[model samples]
Structures are given as C-alpha cells and as structure tokens.
Target: MSGFESNPFADPVDVNPFQDASITQATSGATENVGEFNPFAGTNSGKTIPISAASSQPAVLQTSMEQSAQENAAAGQASLIKQQEELERKAADLERREQELQTGMENNWPPLPSFSPVKPCFYQDFEEDIPEEYHRICKRMYYLWMCIATLFLNVLACLAYFTADSASGVDFGLAILWFVLFTPVSFICWYRPVYKAFRSDSSFSFFFFFFVFFFQVAVYVIQTVGIPRWGNSGWIAAISMIRVNLAVAVVMMVVAGFFTVNAILSVILLKMVHSKYRRTGASFTKAQQEFSSGVLTNRTVQTAATSAASAAAQGAFGRNQEN
Candidate 1:
C-alpha cells in the first residue's frame, strides 16, 4: 500500500500543509488582486447610484432627523403664538389708555372759556338775529325799550322846566315816581304780554295784550299832551315855554319829540299788532285754553302745590300732637 492510502485507524503522520504549491499560488494571487484595486479610479464615470443608497443613512438617524424637524416646527409655531399674544396685550393696553384719556377730557367741570370774554348786548344785524316771522314784533319791542330808556331824558327836561319856572317839589316827585312805576309796569304788563302773545300766536294773550296796550297807548297820548305837573312836556307846554325862554323851549321841544316818537310808535305798532292778530286767527277762547294748559304744567305751580301739601301735612301733625 502507498502512504497516501493509510487507513483511518492508523496513527496520523505530521506533515506541513504549506508545502502545497497550488494553495500558496492561489493565496499570493488573491493578495496581488487586492493590492491592485483602487476605489478613486475614474473609469466608472456615467454610473449613477440611487440617492438613498449613496447616502448610506441609517433608518434610526432618518427618523430622528424627522422628529427634530417636527420639534423645530412646533417651537416656531409656539413662538408665533407668543408674539401674537404680546401684540394683543399691547393693543389692549393702548386702547385702555385712550379710553382713560377720553373720560378725563369729558368730565371737565366749570366749562372752558368762551371765544370772546365779553358778550354782545345788541345784535349787529337785527334781521339776522331776529327770526323772520318775529322781526317786526321784536323791532317794536326794541323800540319800546328805547322809548323807556329815553324817558330819562324826559326827566331831565322836566327838571329843567321846573327849575326855569316855579317848579313844585310835589311835581318833581311825581315825575320820578311816574318814570319808576311806569317803565317796569309797562314792560311787565303790556310789552312782555304782547311779545309773548305774538310769539305764541295765542288769541287770548293777544286780546289781553291789546286791552292793556290800548290803555298804555292812551297813557302815552296823555303824556304827550304834557298836562301841567305831569312827567311830560305836552305840545302846549313846549310852545308856551318857547315864548317864555328859548333854552326852555328847546328842552321842551326835545322832550316833545321823545313823546311824539312814543305816541307814533305805539299807534303804528298797535295797527301792526291788530293786523297780526287778524292773520293769526287767535281768539280769546284759544288764549284761555293755552293759559289753562300753561298754568297746569308750570313748574312754579307744581312747586307751590308741593309746598302746600307739606305745610298741610305739618299742620295736621301739629293738631294730632295737640289732641
């Protein structure tokens, strides 16, 4: 038998496995192929790798990147919400401040100054200031006031007349009393009633004013006649004084002119007022209704009623206590 064909039961012979030339040649060739390989070589130029394969990213790393991106988006959204809240807070603060400022401005006591320090007594354009409907009536009222004020001149004239003649103290006193009593009385009784009558177009008020003013007009005529010891210098007195003393005559004439003005104005105004009354169709009956309504609704009437009630209550209480 040959050595290569030894039986399995026989003792194994120690031999060098490296002594095989073919195995040594195969290992040397594999080493040479590995040493000759170069990854940086430019021969594979046109070949494209899939983007996913070229990146060589792990699945865990990709998932973590996506989660980080989601987290960043959430943080950005939170920051935007915070900014909006901050802007809203600022807007609310500004609105509050504006409201406070407006309230402070509106609550100012003791009102601000007017455009002009002094107010005008007389309106420059009478027509502009007075309503068109009331123009004529208001003008008459103004004229009445003017006439009343001019009576002071009459007093001066009368005093002058008395000084020139045997002026009695009683006459002078009567003149002063006439002025003081007549001026305000005329205003309160005649002029104001007429004014209100025309203003309201009330028939009753118109009739009332007509009656009172008729008497006033008669009084004006009498005053103009210049009766002796009266407040006025009548035409006769003026003429008589003219022959006596030129200066006295001049003063008397001036007073006569004022009297004449008052008389003529009163007559003309009376006619105008009559025409107005006719146009208005105001009657005494309607005037009475208006007066009744006014009295019923008047604050003064209400106040008087309240006072009377309280007084009655107090009196009843006192009587009860006495009983």
Candidate 2:
C-alpha cells in the first residue's frame, strides 16, 4: 500500500498541444533551424556542399521541371511547322486542279447535222476545184441516175396499182409522187447551187446543197417502198414471181442509191472546199469587193511581197491576176 501510494504521488510531465515544439526540442532542432532562418536557404553558401543527395532533391526536381517546359515548347513548334507544311500541300493541289479545268477538256463531239453552212459539216462542195470537163461529166451522170430512178419508180408504181397482193402493193402512190417531186428537185438542187458558184463565186454553196437535198430525201423514202411491189417489166405478173419484181426493185434501188450518194458526195466536197477557203487569204466576198473597188484592176498579184499580199487579200484590197 505504501509503495503504490508513493508511485501515484510521483506524476510525469503533462504535454500541451499548443506548446512551441522548437523551444522544447531546441537542442535537437537548432542545426536545422539555422538553415531555415537563412534568407538564401535553397542555395549553397560560398564553396559549401550538400551533406546528402536528399537535401538537393528539391533543386533537382526544379531543374527537371524547367527541362520538361523547354522540351514541350520545342515539340509545340515542331507540330506547328508540320501543320503549316500540310496546309501548303493542300493549297498546291487545289491550284493544280484549277489550272486543269481552265482548258476545255471534256471528251465529246460537236452536235451533228447542223444546217448552217458557216459551220463545217460532213457534206461539202468542191465542184469548183474539179476540172470543168470532169464536173460536166459528173453532172451528166447525175442526170442519168435521176432519169433511171424516175423510170423504174414509175414502173414500180404501175405494178403496185395493178396487183392486189400486199407484196405487189408497195406504196405506188409514194413512188409516183417521189418521181414527180424529185426528178426536177435533183436538177434544182445542183443546178442553181452550181450556177451561184459560177456566177458569183459564193462561199456558201453548202447552205444551198443541204437546203435542196431536203427534196431529194423524199425520193429515198419512196424508192425504198416501191421495189417490193413493182413487177419486173409487165409480163408474167404474180405474187409467186416476187424474185423478178425484187430484181427490178433492186435495179431501181441501185439507181436511187447512186443519186443519193452523188448528192451526199457533192455536199462533202463542197465542205472541203469551204474549209480551204477559210485558210486562204482571199474569200469570195473580199475578191468581189476588190474587183468592184478597182484595187485589182490590171494589177498583177505577183508584184508585191507575200505578207503585204496576204494582208491585202484578206481584206477588200487585193491585187488580182491579169489574164
């Protein structure tokens, strides 16, 4: 009892939470506080060294942060440069595409069967270039084709009229009408066109050729129907004798084909001539004008230099050849 009472009477010191730990631990903390109180605590004093690597950990971390910032800045600049290069490449591609479209390069042909004579067409007129003798022969041949086509067509019409068979009844009225229509039409188409060429040296023979060919076209349609019905000569006529009728029709078709071919060829040739005319320095209009204006009156074209001659010929002031 005496020992326990004595132990209770002897009490240990009571620690307060608000007490200054440094004042209490001054003996153990005095060295650390010396650096903490110093103004330049992070930097070493002249020639002083760190006692341990842990003491320099904060400085090493600060260095690492600075290095990371610099690397990030450099990487950002590199990214910006790459982005600029990509934009320039896209711009160059757009510019190249724009240049390609400026030139007319879509693949398609011009509209066909144009009636205007000013435009180059498949049909042309070159009767002027052909020798007079050859042209006369061509004209004679054309007329002969016309006559032969007309005669056969008439015979076909006669057979279709007389026969009741569907094969024998081959559009006789159409054939007769074509014969009546195209015989004179063929002459008119070429005759007046050539006459204009001879008389005025008109550059537009193509216009008249196509215009007149409109009439000759009906002959083609009519002839196509007539041959199946028209009996070969008026002798032994029957549906069973279609072979003979076909032969007659074939002959008629041949004649009609010749006429049509001639007309088409004439138009083609005329177009070729007109193409040449465009290249030539003198056109019919300029030549006619020069003649009327007295610029070419007895003036030999061989006298002047070619360039001047070309300029004059292109205009209404060319020198013409003297006979």
Candidate 3:
C-alpha cells in the first residue's frame, strides 16, 4: 500500500500529461472573450444584451427579403385578378348587347319569299333593306337638288332678260323665254301632277306625268339654245328687234320658277300629311291628344275591333263548316 502511494516521480507511469499551454490558453482566452466581449452583443456590461437577435441578423435580412418578395407576388396576383374581372365584365356587356341586337333583329323578321327562279331585285338581307323613311328622305334630297338647279337657271334667265336684244342677238334670249314658259309647264308635268296623284290615287296621273316630263326634258335642251321662230310673238311674226323689259322679264322668270317650286313642295307636304293621316296606327296627333288628356293609351279600342273581326271570322268559318 505504501509503495503504491509513494510513486510521485517514477516516470509518471505513462499517464497523459499537459502537452502545450499555448493551445489551452488560447482556447480558454477565446471562450472568456466570447462570454465577456462577444462580437454579437447588442448590450454590454450594465446594458441589456441581445444574443440571438445579434447572431440572427443575416438570417433575418434573408427572411425579410423573402417576405417582401411574397408581398410583391401577392400584389401582382391581385392586380391580375382585377384585370381578369374587368375583362369578364366587358365580355358580359358585349354579350348582353349582342343578345339585345339579336332579339331586335328577330322581332323585325321579314316574310320568307316563295322559291322563284327569277328573283326580283329587292332588299333581301337583314341589314341591306332600305326603309321607306330612307326612300322618302332620298326623294326629298332629289327634290331639293332640282329646286336649287331651277332657282339658279331662273336667275340666269333674269340676267338674260335684263340685257334684252333681238332674240337672235345673244343666242340665249330664246333660252330665257323657253325656261320661263316651261317653268309652269314642268310643274304641270312633274310636280303638280305627282302632287295630285299622291293626294288621291289617279291611275292616269302617273302615265301622263311620265310622258309629259320626258318631253319637257327634250324641250329644255332645245329651249336652252336660240329659238328658230318660237315664242309668244315668235310663232306668227316676222323677225324684228322687239325690245323687252329686261328687269320685268327676269322678275317674271324668277317669280314663275318660285311658284313652280312652291307648288311642288306644297303638294308633296300635303300628300305626305295625308298619307300619314291614313295610317292611324302611327298618328302622333292621336298620341299627343292621349298624352294631354292624361289617359294612358288604351288598347281597348284596338281589342274591341280585333274581337269583332275575330267573331265575324269565327261565324264565317262555322257557316262554312256546316255547309
């Protein structure tokens, strides 16, 4: 026991001994410095220390960047969704308009034509057909054009008359006379006759106007040139220089042209008014009256008429059946 206890300096009995103090001191110094003067300390000594937050700076920065990216992605998605919704809304509006237009088209469907080899040249498509109102407008435009042309020519005739000479002198005196005469005649041919024909259906009026106006056009061309013995005194007198009242001739021509135009317009308006009067269904006057009377337009009268017609139709059908 004494021998075992007294071996202090007997080659250290192969026990592990301290090698170098430098490495140990360095490791210990490093640990001590980490505890006391750590590089990641938010507070030191008397101040509050934040260890985890200080160490986690790079990680937090990375996380912050990730969150910011996520927020941007969410905003982009929201914007995309809004755009899609707007597109869908626009599409729905277009669809609604399309459906409404289709309904309107179907409601105004024209009657189907019977199969014929020789089809008449008429409006045959949905949108290609011209309305009667459009035709009337075209007619009005043509009439206005004719009125303007006639007015200008009448002014010219007045000029020619104002500078009076032998009807043979200026080659235009006969033109002036013929235009003045034909102004009234043209009214009888085209405007006045059409007016009367439109006012009250006259079968001959159409035929007469058609033929007369055709002749009037020919006369217009011939009359524009110098007349060869053809005017009031022209038909039965020797060629002589008859000095006409220049101002009076022009005034008379203008007055005659205006009368012709006025006659045409008045007749057309009268016929239009009369025709509109016949279509009781489209009577604005009736509508206005009903509106002023504060009575909602009632279908009672229409229904009564329809019922009477239906009853008559039914009675006729029953009689035929019995027979």
Candidate 4:
C-alpha cells in the first residue's frame, strides 16, 4: 500500500528496506570483527596466530623501509670516517717529508761547534750561517784568520830553531810567549771586531778596527824586514840563515813569506772593508752620531745622572733647612 511496496503488474521492481538493512548490518559486523582481530593475540594453545596478508603487509613494508634507511645512514657514516682518516694520514706524511727534506739540505754544509779551545772567540759556518750579501767579506775575514794561525806556526818554527840552538833560548822563549799572547789577542781585538763591524754595517767599529789593525800591519812589515837578533825571520835573517843550515834557512824563508802574506792580505782586506763601508754610506759623521746616541742612551749614564740630581736636591733641602 505504500511507495515501498513491490509493483508486480506494470514493471518488476522490488523495494525491500529490511533486506538492505540486513545486508548493511552483516557487512558492518564483518568489518568490526576484522578491526578487533589481533595478530599477536594468544590462541587456545597460547600461541599467537600469524597476521593476515591484508593487515600485516603495510607494517612489514614500513619496517623494511626503516631498516633500509638505517643501514644506508650507517654506511654513509662509515665512508665519511674513512675519508677523514685518509686525509689526516696524508697531511702527516706531507709534513714528515718536508722535515726530512729540510734535514737533508742542512746536512750539505759543515756544522761549526759552539766552543773551541784555540778559536774560542768567534765561530760561524759562513755559507750556512751568514747572509748571502756578506759571504764574500766573511770569507776574506776567515782567510785572514787562517793567515794568523799560519803566523803562529811560523812562530813555532822559530821556536824550534832556538830549541836546537840553546844559546838563543831567549828568542825561543819570547817566540813561545808571542804565540801565547798574540793569537788570542789578535782574534779577540781586531779580527772579531772587524767581523762584527762588516757583518753589522757598523761605522764606529770599522774605524776602531782600522786604527788598531794599522799598527798590526806595521808590525807585519817590521817582521817581514827580518831584523837580526829577533825571533821573527826578517829578510836579513832568512837569506843569511841559509848559509848556516839549510833547514834553518828554509824555516826562516817560510816565516818571512808568512809575514809578507799576512801584510798583503791585511792591506787588501782593509781596502775591501773601506770600500764596503763607503758603499753603505757610512762616514765619520755617522760614527760621531752613533757614539753620541750610545752615550746618551747608556743605562749607567742615566743612573749616574739620576743619583746626582737626587743628591743635589738633598743638598739644597739641607741648605734651606739651615737658612
């Protein structure tokens, strides 16, 4: 009788609300059961059932994805660590190689000792220690030093002569004394001073050494002249001693030659030093300026002045008190 009733005469049409309702209820109940089901839930035998493909497929895929991501992250971290370690090792190797090369280069030159019994005053490995610009001048100074040493040997040779002739023991003793006195004195006074002057471009030291060394050059000349009765083999003794004994003559001649060589070298080196000093634009005026500056800036001078001023102040105070 209602619109929901089935029409069988005109057109075959069914309208069954209860049937549709029952179908919907059945579907909803099945969905509820599926949602309530747990794969890890205990069974009658206390064992969990395996999850159905429909429920577990997404979880399995998600777990596999997470595990893959973690593995990739771990692999990336390991690779970065390896790269960092390799870079550090390479840097260390490079630094070690550089040090080895430096050591090898340094080994090429002869090393000088800090102290020596004979040559105790100055020690410098010219090629390795001095600046390139000063090498020529320093070499000249070293040659001069060697010449002084040779001069000592000449004195020893003269001493040997006097040892053979006991009557001339005075000359031998004097020769020995000269060797002892002159060797260290010349080195410390003239040679070392000139070395420092040229090396430092100092005008005052250069002039001071010049005046002292001029006297040294004069002594060399007098020795080369070879006056008789002296320990040195002047030209007079060198030729005359040859007739007495061939060995004595040879020693005297050698000594004479050493003196001549020393004289010539000293003059040459002096000229060279003068030229260098001039090239540096150093002059007497500059030397005076340096000396004045040195005296003005001296600690002792300043201290003395301070004491004098304080004493004067105290004296004035005493006089004022008396007044």
Candidate 5:
C-alpha cells in the first residue's frame, strides 16, 4: 500500500518552483524601483524650467506702470510749453501794430500841399487813430457833415431864387450868414468832439460831443419846420410859396425834404453814438477828471498861473515894504 501512494509522478526529493533564483531576483529588483520612485523630482536630463513666484510677478508689473506714467507727464508738459509760446507771439504782433500807429500820427491831417496858404490845423487818420470797431460810424459822421454843408448850399440857392420875386431879401442874406457861420462852427463843435472821442477814447470828448450833438439835433428839428425868416426852406415855407410860384415852391419842397431827412438821421445817429458811448466805459466822473487834468496841463493855464503868482509876489513885497 505504501509503494502505491508514492507513484512515479511525484519527485523523489522535495522541489518548489517559487523558490527559484531567477524569479526571486526579478521580484526583488521591481520592489526596489518602486520604493525609490518620486513624482515631484526632475526628469532624467538634469535640466529644470524655473517658474516665477507670485510676489516677484507684482514687482515687474509695478515697474512697467511707473514707466508709462512718466511718459504721460512728459507729454503734458510739452503741450503747455507750446501754448505759452503761441500767446507770446500774439502779444508781440499787437505791440508792433500799436507802434506803427503811433509813428503815423506825427503826420499832418488833410494832407494839403505845403505851398498852399491854408495849413492843416488838425490830424486825422481813420486807420491810425480810430479803432476798427468805430471806423464805419466815424466815416458816416464825416459824410453826414458833408451832406449838411451841401444842404446849406442848396438852401442858399433856393433863398436867392425866392428873393428874385418876393420882397424878402432878408431870407437870402440870413441864409448866406447861416452858411458861413454854421458850417465851420458845426464842424468844430460836434464833429471834432466825436472824432476825438473815438480816436482817443476820451471821456471828456465824449461828454462834449453829447452836449453839442443834442443842440445840433434840436437845430435839425427847427430847420425841418422851416420857420418864417429863419434861412431854412422848411415844410411850412414851401407850402405857403405854392400859391405864388409853383417852380419856386417845388424847389423849396425839395429842400424841405432834405431837411426832414437830416433831422431823422440826426436822431438815429444820436442813438447810435449813445450806444457806442455805453460800450466805451465812459462816465461822468471820468469826464470830470479828464477835464480837470486837461485844464491843469494847458500851456495857457500854466502861463496864467505863473503870471498871477508873480503879480501876487510883487504885491506882497510892496505891502511889506510899505509896512
């Protein structure tokens, strides 16, 4: 029975496949590789790609922003400097223009021939003296004065024709006197004042112009009415003469129409001058100051004052000697 259990399939000596040298060595090697493995380690090439820290990134970004801000400030400063240079150039141009005008004012007005007996008593230049804003109005005033002179001549002619038939030679003589009297006086009184006012922005001249021009407007109204024996061929005088001579009346009516036009223009110009005056910053106080200064600075006034002082000094010396 013992021999039957121990058959030929079973090895006589004890043997195990798991205990072989080659298999044992392979398992030991695999276990050692697993134990030495590390996921965070560098690759086998021995080179690494360095990553920047969060704190270091902020420093680099801040340096770039500071450089951009500096560039913007430099640009702004350059713009301001350019604007200042432009303003200075404009100021220089204005000053040059003012100097040219001052030099031009030395020449005489009317520019009459030197050999002529009549000399220019005033200086006038619209471009040199009058501001650009007041040039048109100043020229209009001059034209108005010329029209007034022409109207006076027309009135004289009408009166001379009226005197040929009517017994009233007085009207013709008075017309001649008015032509001679008012032509020069009106030029000096109102026209010159307004011219000087616009030229120099003189408050005193402005006030004088206003005063004289008011009377001038009143004269225009009276002349338009054509009072009898007043040298004016006004509406009433023209209508009355229609009974005797239609031709003479027609001439007189034309003169009356011209006078009416003059009156209307005078009122309009008065308002215009007042509006200009308001813009000039003129006032009563400034006018008074200018008048006082002008009087004090006058050569005649200074001479008179010197003479009076000398006379008083002599008189006081005489009184002291007598005492």
Candidate 6:
C-alpha cells in the first residue's frame, strides 16, 4: 500500500502509457521553445512580422494634404489669370471697332450711269459717308434740297402761266433766271456745306452752312411775302391777281403756298442742323486752325501768296530805292 500510494514529498512521474520516445522528444523541444520565447523581442525568422506604421501616418497624410491644397490653389489662380486675359482681348477688339467706325470708310456716292457724259461732282452716300447717329438728319437735309428745287420749278411754271395772259413777262423771265441761278447756287452754298459738315464733322463747313443757310432762310421769307415784281408769286402777288383773274389768283396762291412751305422747311432745317452741329464737338478755334492749315496746304493759295509776297517785296525795294 505504501509503494502504490503517492507520497506528497515524492517527485511526480509521467502516467501516460501510450507516449513514445519521438513524441516525448517533440513535446520537450516545444516546451524548451516556449520557455525561451520573449513576447517583446524581434523575430529571429528570416521573414519579419508586419506592423502598422501608424505613428508616421498622420505626418504623411498632413504633407499630402498640404501639397494637394497648394496644387488646388495654383489651379484656381491659373484659371483666374486666363479669364482676365480673355476679357482684356475682347475689350481691345471693341475699342478698335469703335475707332474704325468713327473714322469712317471708303465711299461710293452719286450712283451715276457709266454711259452718262455728266460725271458726279460730289460724293453723296449717306450710309457710307455719314455716321449712324447722323443718317436721319443728313437725309432730311437732302430731301429739303429736293423740295426746294421742286418748289422753284413750280414757281417757274406758275410764272409762265401768269405771263400767258400778258400779266408780266418780266416776272416770267426773272422766274426762269432765279430757277437756273439759285438751284445750283443753293446746292453748292448751303446744301453741300451742310452735307460736308455731317460727312466729315468739318467745323468750317458747319460755319459756312450756318452763314449761307441763314441768308437762304431770309430769301425764303422774302419769297413767301410775294413782293410784287420780284419774280415770286407769293401772298401779295396772288392776292393782287384776284382782281384780274380768279383762275390766275388760284394758281398764284398755290405757288405762294409752295413758297410758304419752303420758308417753313428752311427754318426747321436750320434748327435741326444747328442742333446737330452742337453735338459735333466742333469749335471756332478748330475751324480757324483747319482753315489755316487748308489754306497753307493749298497749291493755288500758296502760289497766289508767293506771287503777292514777291510783288510786295519788289514794291518795297522800289520805294526804298526812291527814298
């Protein structure tokens, strides 16, 4: 019993009967490895265990975020610069177009037939020669000139009709002369000057037109008054004819109405032209400068001036010799 019973002080022994030497050796080797293992030590195996580099992650992420922010900012700046440049280019193009429009372009006026012996003396295209702002007013001036010419023709016809009854051959003859003389002269003096004023914004032309057209307005008023024996079949003349012949009076009254219309139109056109002139940025000084320059540059004026100077110098020398 003593031999079979385990003693408390005695060493413990293996009780497994199926255990082999190889198994025992393996178990003992595993036990030895477990005893030598250190949890904190680095691996001895050729392959190392992977660890998360979480300590460096925030730094790398911060650096990448900074770089990305810089790149985004650069992209935004580049886009802004490009947009600014595009705006500048468009603005310059608009300015260039405005300048070209203001300066005007080539003209093709007085649209005449090629076979006609009479050549067009003046350029008269409203679209090509005049600015958009001045087109309506300029055309109105042209129409006024036409109306005036038509009125003159009507006056001539009325005078011829009056003369047929032996009323006054002088009036008829004078009407013809007035028609022929005034038609072309009025065109050259007032109409052409106003046209040129609008076409080139010429200060001199504006001044000339104002001067001549004022006198023209006065003439229209005179003609409207129908001063007897002055060639105009105006109110007085028409009223006087009523005593002689009713039909002649009626015809003369019609002519007088035409003259009245001409007078009214002249006054209205003068006001219109003046308003346009006010907006043209023209001045008396500028007109003077232009006149001076034009005169100085003219070959005819220069030649005449030179001849006058030579004559004066010769006269002065002769006077000096006499002295």
Error of 2 at 234 (Å): 19
Q: Judged by lDDT, which candidate is best?
A: 5
Q: For each candidate, what is the lDDT? A: 0.75, 0.51, 0.51, 0.75, 0.82, 0.81
Q: State the lDDT of candidate 4 residue by residue for 1-323, as single tens digits.
A: 68758555754666776679889899899999999988867654575557685698899899999999999999999999999999979977986896686555533222346463333223445565556777898788767866776557666767766755666566566666767877777877787677767666778877778888888889788778876666676677668766667787787788888888888988898888788777877788878887888677678998999999999999999999999
What are the models' TM-scores? Answer: 0.53, 0.31, 0.24, 0.54, 0.62, 0.62
Answer with 4 or 6, whichever has the higher TM-score: 6
Q: After superposition, how far is residue 6 of candidate 3 from its true place, in Å?
A: 99
Q: Mind giving the per-residue lDDT tens digits that candidate 3 earns over 36-80?
A: 875655656457648987889999899999999999999999999
Residues forming the 10-long window of minimal summed lDDT in candidate 2: 231-240
lDDT per residue as tens, model 5, 1-323:
88887768767877788799999999999999999998767665666545656468889999999999999999999998999999878877886797786666655755789998887777778897799999989998887777676457555655755665575566677777777888888889999999999998999999999899899889888877888777777788788788777888788888888888888988888889889999999999999999998788578999999999999999999999999
Per-residue alpha-carbon lDDT of model 6 for 205-261, expressed as tens digits? 999999999998898888888787677778887788777778878887888888888
- Please count the clashing residue pairs in each candidate, in the order shown: 3, 12, 0, 2, 0, 0
lDDT of 2 by residue, 1-323 (tens): 77666655555666675476766587557777775686765676555665787688989999999999999999999999999999979977886795586343432222344574444222223363445533553454344444445445455535444453454444455456556755556655655554444334444543454455544444444443334434222222322345645655344444445445554554554555445435434355764564454333334544455668778776644334431
lDDT string for model 1 (34-117, tens) is 999988678667677798886777876899999999999999999999999999799779968966865554322223446755
TM-score of 3: 0.24
Against the true structure, candidate 5 reaches a TM-score of 0.62
lDDT at 285 for candidate 2?
70
Tell me the TM-score of model 4. 0.54
The residue-level lDDT of candidate 4 at 242 comes to: 68
Report the Cα lDDT for candidate 2. 0.51
Model 6, C-alpha of 220: deviation from truth (Å): 0.8
